[model samples]
Target: MATSPQTRKAIADSENALRDTLWTDAADRLWAHKTSGGFVTTPKTMPYVCRILDEMSKDHPLASTYEALWSYTWANNAFLRFNKPDDVTFAAGFSGQRGRRTLLERMRRLQLLGFIETQPNGNETFGFIFLPNPHAVLFRHQAGQGTPLPDPAPKGLSTHILPASWNAFVARALDLGCKDVKLLLNPPPPAPVSAAAPAVPAALTSPKVLRRRPKAAAKA
Candidate 1:
């Protein structure tokens, strides 16, 4: 997921700089310095990357978590696959040595959100479509600001996303006696063009047709 030209270059730069500061054979020495427990001498890397995963969870609350899950099934939600320090450092957006704490906090929060589902084998995954309809949980059982389900909108607030398309979906479901329906929120309207007035052509400017003011009087 973090595989890109920018990321690859960043990794190289980080490793080279680290090698210069730590030792010319720092990479080799570090690799060989593992303990009897099969742990790296510098074992802070896992927690650091986990923190990045956490931030991703916090950012979208549910949407991003769903994206994360769906990635395994479809796309790899921009999650950095490389756990190496240099590889992670090179990855933009996801890589932030400074943002480690924030990311961890978010991942913890997302787990509590019920958005992430644990598989039989204890695999953690998320998906875009709530195949069984997560909206049911939000509308009836569990719902709030931070959970997997979307928060309830204000009273009488109907959705407008693909009006015809959604209505068709609702119609199909309604026939099966489904009482509740949830839809994606529509984006805000574009700025309104001034229909009351005609647009002025840039070529026919007031300075060309009307009187112009002379330059301001200057002090002697």
Candidate 2:
């Protein structure tokens, strides 16, 4: 579809903002691992984690790197962009260990949330974990949980969405965490089938009711 100038500009602006802030520093620091100890959750913790991720992306296995990347995508969304998926990743370099965390911690959080069962593989320093809301992970990467954003272009043959298209946008976002998603916006409630459904039925119209309750109660 032909993207309008306004929509293109907005998408471009958003892309620039994300790249400059999250991707730049993250790509540079992904591989620096921390084997001596775990992550320190201090006021300065973010920088340390970012550094480790920077090195890991380039050095770790593809699976490990993707995990770290997704992790960073989630945290970045929560911390920076207010809990939305960064759809720009479709174009932004998807490689890089932009996100990683202690495996014990990851497993604990996942188990606590009842997203998965816990098991040990006997790996130290960093254990692998399962994430149930991988789709939400995408949304957390692409879109946030706050008041949804306005789509720059109206959806037609192809485009993001039109202005004030919160429902469609949210539907797209929710699809990240849900499967076979279907969203109905402002759908009218089903109309009542009968204007007046007889409490006692039509009675004489049916022999069963005429035999059960007397006609007087039926009429009343």
Candidate 3:
């Protein structure tokens, strides 16, 4: 029996709708977690997220890696996920002979490019984290003036492992006039100083200068 074109179209539409709903649900959960401070480190803002997606989509070699990241994000219900590179590769739908190595290489490439960050999980496993440009516009719209920047992802969630080449990547991003995108590269602020600590004496705080007048007089 031949399936009618109308029936096929309906099925396709249904799949699309289902996928959209899943993505929306996942995003909502992540947003809720962020609001509740479940993520010690902040997830990338929507704008930054969108920008990263755009860049990854344009890179053919990174297509599978990008999909893997999306899957992990959905599975974790947040931007942080605890999984080995092999696990992520399998989750991305890569199977069969040689698929694992290929996927692992792709993951490494993404990390080298600064699209993803990873930290050790103590048991020889790794925790992967996504770093996208922050959504400054959305943040401003929702937070209004004087709003603090987003917090870093929780230490438990990600070690915030950065590659040694990260400096070069940041420099390139800034040179490209991508100030907003480069915001993610900045280090988090230091923890606030304790108010209970004793203050240093004013005299000790002042700069000291050595007098050279005696030496000059001796020379003359």
Candidate 4:
């Protein structure tokens, strides 16, 4: 059955509200981190995190999983470790939607892309620890240093390309505090240049011209 326009609008509005909530939560957490010295060594990391979250699209296959994991890590300021695959699976929200193997594969892809690093516990009873490095990933993305791995699943695949104006979005997000949220959705204009002072005319600057020829005609 075809969906009505009102239904589509309602769906869009809900999605947008969810997105806003996610970012606002991220921003608030980042502010808390800032106050608590979470970024003392790497103050630059906070902005990168905000930029990545702002640029992330809901259509990405691992968007929810990644966001959830990042939020967990950011709040705790530590790696998320699990003793069982079920723990990791549930945390990533892949219990019914996907299997543990798929979760591991997605994590491996993220690791390869520099977005995450994993360390095995060496005990079969203990699963692994996932260390998220969104700042490093954002830097690598900006520098074109790594290739984004394609998702094996057919549904909701994304190229994961960073837009050229990512920095501008980050700046606006930090300075404006979500006042003009639509600005981040659109492409940013070129860097603003200061307006130069108006040029003075040569005619105005030079001395006034004297009419000496009229006097010669009167003599003739």
Backbone clash numbers for all candidates listed: 4, 27, 8, 0
Cα lDDT tens digits, model 4, 1-220, are: 2356798789878886887787867444545644676442323335545445434432334544555455455345556665456666677777765667766655554555556666667664224456544544554566566566555633333325466546564564445344333333344899999999999887766655343356669899
* TM-score to true structure, per model: 0.24, 0.20, 0.33, 0.42
lDDT of candidate model 2 versus the reference:
0.36
Model 1: worst 10 consecutive residues (lDDT sum): 40-49
Residue pairs in candidate 3 whose N, alpha carbon or C atoms collide under 3 angstroms: 40-153, 40-154, 41-152, 41-153, 41-154, 42-152, 42-153, 48-133
Worst 10 residues of 2 by lDDT: 153-162
Ranked by TM-score from best down, the candidates are 4, 3, 1, 2
Q: Rate the local accuracy (lDDT) of all candidates.
A: 0.37, 0.36, 0.50, 0.54
Error of 1 at 77 (Å): 16
Q: Model 1: clashing residue pairs?
A: 54-107, 55-103, 69-126, 71-75
Give the C-alpha lDDT of model 1. 0.37
Give the winner by TM-score: 1 or 2: 1
| Model 2: CA > 4 A from native | 1-103, 115-117, 123-128, 133-170, 174-179, 183-220
User: TM-score of predicted model 2?
Assistant: 0.20
Candidates in order: C-alpha RMSD to true structure = 21.6, 18.7, 18.4, 16.0
Candidate 2 C-alpha lDDT tens digits along 22-84? 677764655543654433222122232223323222332123323333344333331112122
Regarding lDDT, does 1 or 2 come out ahead? 1
